[model samples]
Target chain A: MDGMVLVITSGKGGVGKTTTVANIGAALAALGRRVVLVDADIGLRNLDVVMGLENRIVYDIVNVMENKDLPVRKALIKDKRVESLFLLPAAQTRDKDAIKPEQMKELCEELRQEFDYVLIDCPAGIEQGFRNAVAGADLALIVTTPEVSAVRDADRIIGLVEAEGLRGPRLILNRLRPDMVKRREMMDIEDVLDILHIDLLGVVPDDEAIIISTNKGEPIAFDNNSKAGQAYRNIARRLEGEEVPFQSFDNPSFFQRLRQLVGMDK
Target chain B: MALLDFLSRVLNRDEGSKETAKQRLQLVLVQDRASVNPHLLEELKEDLIGVISRYLEIDLSAMEINLESGGGDTVALVANIPVRQVRRSQQK
Candidate 1:
């Protein structure tokens, strides 16, 4: 079966693209799917570190392309916790110019034949890195935060994705603070979607656990307590075309709320 | 205390608040897709004045244009022209 090539990218940096890739890949694997997370950020690789597979990288997409002795299966580091999840690290030595778009597409095709979900970690900016990253993808998962600059870049990327004849990009609004938005101090979810005008994949709340997970090389999805982690899991489900109810991040106290029934004398 | 809380609740509540994220997102995206900043937009208006005045009698002072964000309050473009006043004077 042909695999789904979903490139997780945001044109602007530091908006949690790699984090989303790590967590979503982990979540998908936990759901019993064979998923391979490819780090296409070349020379600026970080997905491996985010996925906690940094110390295990021997070969990468570059190696596979250069006809090196390293086997594709060997380059793929399997997660011990999630049996089906694997990571193909980016080459730290090579630049984005080293690879072409067609080569990236061919690499994805080869991986597609073997895996179920091929998630690509695209580098930031609309340069060769961005072009090479989305070359092989069937769908693009545009990640953005509540901030304006990131949203702007995400818009440009989505337009480019559509121009490439790919489907209209799906959105993952990461690191959102509902409380701040409720205070009118920050932009809320509706304001974001109204501009992008794409179907919402999921909303990830701003949570410190994501940072802790990154430091430990653990994906936030495994925690299940942090809001961001839960968001990533829901995103994984939505990507699988499952109907998942989005939690009201603005009202986290609602779940704990059970209205008291006051007695009315008849 | 109850009154204070109630007042805060009533005055601070945003009925259409749920749509804020989507609303702000749309405005940013439009600017992003266009690659044209507000300053550049002003420059375009100024340049248009030079091009437009060559043949047509247009209102140079009454042109008002802005980037839109849709929560329906002030999301659409508002443009005014002085053609009506000029035409009325001509008719008189």
Candidate 2:
């Protein structure tokens, strides 16, 4: 049976596309699904580093797409921690034009036959790299932040994804701060959903553990206490067709909450 | 009085950064969804003035052309042209 080709893309850079791919790939593998994370951001590849598989890369995706004799398995680097998780690194020396859309589709087809999920790390912008990353995908996960610019870029990307004949992309709003939202200092999930008008895949709260994990070259999904990690796992479960209620990022003070519950406080 | 005013300001806060974000996003997203660039709109407005002025006495400066989002997936190009009077040759 062929697996799903889910391309994780954000039109703007630094909106956590690579981070989402790494965390979700790890989460899915932990759920016992064989997953392959493909970094389609050719020259500026970072998915391998995020997954801590940078040193293990013997062959890149460019080599696999170019060489007819080379088997695709040779480039698949199994994650050190997760048994079922693997990564297909991108070529740093080559440019985005090195691999055509058709070649990327063919590569995904071969990968789908072996893995349960083919998660592609799409590059920023609506160019050749974006086209190549999106060509083979059955589902598109548009990642964005609560910031105005990121949301605008995500809106543009949603139009392009639908125009490509792919299904309507689900949104993953990353780097949210519930405290800021409560204080009316930041855009909340509802405000974002109102504009994007797509089904919500997940909402990831801004957590410092994410940065720590990234620095350590490990996916935050393994840390149970990390709110962002829990969000990624929830996204993975949602992808697996599970209906999970969104976790409350509300600040809970025992005394105030108790008073509210007893109808003594507003 | 100053302390109470400060407390009220802190407690009764309504408009915040999120409100600003929402307003900005709504305006920008409408333009983005309509695929209407401001520069392109300006050029279109100029060309439209030249074309319409040749046939009628119109207020070119007062004309308004806007790309509006008419809800789900519809972009409406609404143009308001104020015609002062029709040209005598065109009236025939």
Interface RMSD of each: 4.2, 0.6
Error at A76, model 2, angstroms: 0.6
Clash count list over all predictions: 19, 0
Off by over 4 Å in 1: A68-70, A251-256, A260-266, B1-32, B35-92
C-alpha TM-scores of all predictions: 0.77, 0.83
lDDT of 2 by residue, A104-214 (tens): 999999999999999999999999999999999999999999999999999899888888888879999999998788767899899999989999999999999999999
What do the candidate models score in CA lDDT, each in turn?
A: 0.81, 0.91
DockQ of each: 0.23, 0.70
Fnat for the candidates in order: 0.37, 0.97
Instruction: List runs of model 2 lying over 4 Å from the truth.
Output: A256-266, B1-8, B11-14, B36-65, B68-78, B81-92
RMSD of each: 6.8, 6.2
